[model samples]
Target: MYIKLLYSAIALVACTSARPQQLSLSLLPPAQQVFVQPAQQNNAIEPSINAINKPTNPIVVAAFQREALLPPHMQNSFYKNPKIAETLAQNSWFGPGEQHAVNRETEKIPREKIFIILKNAGLLPTP
Candidate 1:
């Protein structure tokens, strides 16, 4: 099939070479020819930034609480499951960052990046 396609392309090029054609090109209009510019800038070009509504700790606390409510056997798997662990750690700024105070570790890896890596590795759920 590829050989036939290649042959067809070669035939097209060969056929086109047998004829001569002229093509017309046009130059762009000068700045003066363009529409008049507006004097005033748009009032609201960007959307306002707002803080996230839910605090991060409650979700983590909820997950732990939910796990505690589960049977002892299920609790082990709930906590240990990589997907659950990674989801609970979502950092899309996904959830809030670092709950506890920390001064050490100069280059802290964002949880979103960690979640991305785990998601790529099939350890976390992929959207």
Candidate 2:
């Protein structure tokens, strides 16, 4: 009972004495200014939206065409394939274990590279 009373008293004191953490922006070091030069304009004309959308890689273009031709029901099965799952896992920047599998930057990598990856894995045939 005495120990309990002591603990309760200690807890009360601790609670009463505790103060919220205070932060001031003035206390922080000044942020360094980084100046970026404006990008130079090129004389070359920009590609049209059609050209941008179109797959330049033959293998990717053929795969896309084949997928487009498939019925809606078949299209569902194509995406759900285990081989595609494995390929996605392999292509992902992060993996299950300690291995840093950021082999390719996800955003920057083209769809053609993914198609090529699938083709090399024997999931897709060469076009």
Candidate 3:
């Protein structure tokens, strides 16, 4: 009986410990490890001040302004509906003039530029 119990215990332990084998290595081809030359490293280490100093491209700035200002849902909605896009495109400011009258009265800034201004002011997130 004791031998049978021992054998059962051992079998139980073995069964519990058994696990499926896994692949040891990735299927992808081995990556080539390139050694960077010292001269290349030195050149790359210093960024060009002139490159950083360059003025922002107007088109890129406008695109970024558009990206950073509009919410993802609004952006999606605008893209989905031509009428919405037309309305948005036609308006200089968001919403009817009545809702944003205070903003209009307080800041002489045009409604079209308000989104950008609000984004710059940290009131809104990038779309």
> In lDDT terms, which candidate is top?
2
Sort the predicted structures by lDDT, highest score first. Answer: 2, 1, 3
| lDDT tens readout by residue for model 2, 31-101 | 32232322323321122222224323332333444454556566656445768855764574344565422
For each candidate, what TM-score against the reference?
0.20, 0.20, 0.17
RMSD of each: 25.1, 26.5, 26.9
How does candidate 1 score on lDDT? Answer: 0.36
Residue runs of model 3 more than 4 Å from their true location after superposition? 1-51, 72-127
Candidate 1: stretches off by over 4 Å: 1-55, 76-79, 82-84, 87-92, 95-127
Off by over 4 Å in 2: 1-56, 77-127
> Global CA lDDT of candidate 3, please?
0.35
RMSD of 3: 26.9
**True lDDT of residue 34, candidate 3:** 32
On residues 12-66, what C-alpha lDDT tens digit does candidate 1 reach at each position?
A: 4433322111100111112212322223223211212212334433223333444
In candidate 3, position 80 carries an lDDT of 43
